[model samples]
Target: MELGVFLFRPLIRNRADFKQAEETLKKSEVWIRNIFKSLKEAVFVITPDRIFLDMNEAAQEMFGYTKEELVNRPSAIVHIDHEQYLEFGKKMEEVINKGEITNFQFKMRRKNGEIFPSEHTASLMVDNEGKPIGIVSVVRDLSEQKKIEEEKEKLQAQLQQAHKMEAIATLAGGIAHEFNNALTGVVGNIELLEMRLPDNKIVTEHTEAMKSSSHRMANLTSQLLAYARGGSYQAKTISLSDFVEETLPVIIPNIGPSIRIDTDLPRDIFKVNVDSAQMQMVLSAVVSNSSEALGGDGRIRVITSNEEIDAEFAKSQPGLRPGRYVCLTVEDDGEGMDEETVNKIFDPFYTTKFMGRGLGMAAAYGIIRNHGGWISVDSEQYKGTVVRIYLPAIEAEKKVKKEIITEPKLDIAEGEGTVLIIEDEEMVMNVTRAVLVRLGYHILEAKTGKEAIEIAKTFDGQIDLALLDIKLPDIQGDKVYPLIMKARPNLKVIVCSGYSIDTAQG
Candidate 1:
């Protein structure tokens, strides 16, 4: 017997000892073989020529090929039987000849033509002399695992979609609530005026209130559209310094009487290529929050500087990198927040204010992100709050003065034959006519759709250009425009709408 050929954890005593060792080796081999046979995994051996030499009982049961039919057959013959690809089989042969061990995953067919995914662990077999002989492969089906992975990814995407919808729904509700309150004030004022004012005197106050409220409505709609991530705007170079200075007075008053605003913006407009409207939004939301942080009586400082934020600086901030940027810092000595509260500042509907609901800062984050910029905030309770906005910088470009549009002057026909201006709002009509009258254009006025139309048909001879408002009582201006256009075909028509142009188009 070769030394160490069979291992027995005991002392050998002559030829009898050698015979006992041989019996022990035989018993161990039977035990290992029985264990292999019990496993459901299919086991097979392939000769160097890629021909199958043996298939375990499990393999035979799985492939529906008997030992007689499979042994001595070239591995390629099983291509149809096992649904293995020819290219993969060839690759396996190449790997075997190269004496490399490998594990493979593939789909193989059964006798019934049903394909199932499988994972295989295979290595070249060798004799006791370490000479290469054939290949042994242990294969297990992986169809179940693949199914689980696909289902997990599908569920993940669905969850993401659901989260997005829920966020948008919350934002919509916030905007709607604010808008309803504003509209109620405007509508109530107009309704009160309708009861007291005489037809001629109706052109006094509520109309201007209506116009102001209409513009506010437009502004609100614009913000909601941005939060909704819809609409596109043309990008252009804008001077931040000048824009901020102009917005200072407007934002300052909104902060209330308790706050003192000090601005440190450079005189030069730090120019950037972005939509001006969106930038205004970013400025407004941040400044408003800073103001609120002060709780009505504190000082706020807006400082702008040229900064180069490098990778190291960005690492501390997260999601930022080294770049030449313009930093706009809004700092306020007010009631500040903790670190945990700040991290979630950009999540929609996350707010510290009891009355505040929509995460307006989230809108600011999205806006800055879209502008190829980043925002970071630092704060501590009662110390102060500071928000730093890092925006990429561009080389200063030559400025081209924009051509201001001058309207063509209208030649007025000399005749004050009661040029009735049919508009529902009295103040807007009165103010407009006052301006036109100052310019020598005769003005006549009606306050509603029914009254305006009645005045138009009653006035005899060239009624002149009727300055018409599209929105009115009893009927829409759009419905009135066509009737006025058709009945008074010869009358010059000028259309006016407080908010939407659609009224006149109709």
Candidate 2:
């Protein structure tokens, strides 16, 4: 009787232990299920035969399917294609054989049939005996990540381009300044020669030819200065819409008749302070670029509107500020450029045409930038192109009508005065002295600002006018002006510079 009771006791103890073990297993399974559902990454369980066994909430959301719909179904439905599925399966099998996990990027399909990039991490699940049962995979959608990476790369490229353009602009400005100084000598000498040999027809012809060539070179230098952001000579606040309307007549003849132009210049547009001639050049260049894009027979729309740039939008674009802006949009239905070509369009000397100066768009870019404006371009292959130029706007009440004044050309009448010429370049100084001396003015020359200041202080003769070069080796012309004024308070001063008057003053 004691042995039988002990056997029953052992059976009762075993039953109690089994019940406790079953409850613990149930709790663990619930905990694991809760963790799986709470996961952000899509988790999936697949049978060894590549059939979907179960999936978490994230997985169902990611693939646009419910667990009940995908369970017991082939996993190929989520893959980009059957061939990709097979390849992925082979790779998974190879990794499992090596007792490793599979991780890779693969294109995946959503329920709506949209294909997208996805990162997949998969491993084999095993039973208690260590035999493979199914696959456990965690997938991450890489679409947003790829987009962010692409945006970062684009910003980096834009920064590099801005640096390159800045360097180029410095070089161009220096060259233009030096070239203008040299041209001053040439043009002055030619004028003196013309004055001396007025009666000689042959000499007049040669001198005129030289003058024409020099004038053309001067124009080229002006364009270079424009591209260097030193070209706005006379900036005035005016109605941009009116200015465009007046300038389009002159520009239309240049663009062939096949290219139709439509303008929507609303009179209510905000006014902008810009150099009229430079703005005209910008408009002409932008129109010409669009015209060239259209081999022939395409519509071009020029529209102007008031726009307000917000801080967030301004922050995304370099060198842009938040403000009320007047936007000029030029849209063209023509052969467009690819991304690579569009990137280089604003670079100096970059062009797609067989014959082009390539400075048109570059100068346009500089002119707008110099006027406190920004330019942007959008294009697609075979689709079209759109360009937007934004200039800071002023209140309409500040708009002023600029009057046109025509000045008749006057002959160089001889003058009697004592003139002081302060110039650094030897050729420019010599030619200027000769021209003044020829005009019956006594010349006092100084190659440096110090020399000029000394001449103003100690010179016994009455100094009538002082011609001061803005740029000097010893002291800048602006600084020298105040110092020399201390000595010669009554002397009249004329400021000269290779740069525009506005830039020179600043």
The candidate that wins on TM-score is 2
Global lDDT of each candidate:
0.65, 0.81
Deviation of model 2 at 249, angstroms = 1.1
Least accurate stretch of 10 residues (summed lDDT) in model 1?
Answer: 397-406
Tens-digit lDDT string for candidate 2 (107-127):
999999988899988887665
* Quality of model 1 by C-alpha lDDT: 0.65
Maximum-lDDT candidate: 2
1-506 in candidate 1: lDDT tens per residue? Answer: 21122222345679998898778867776776676578788987776677787767898887778889888887664454544556657656766667777787777777677778878787776555555567777888788898988777755644554366347745654564345334544654554454346474546565766768767776665455445443234457666677678778766666679788888888653566666767777888888888888777888888888787777666445445576677889998887888667756666668686216664776677666556677877889778889988777655323212211223344444445445577766666655565456446667777877776776667665666777765577887767777776767777656544332211221
TM-score of 2: 0.88
For each candidate, give its TM-score against the true structure.
0.38, 0.88
Predicted candidate 1, C-alpha RMSD: 17.4
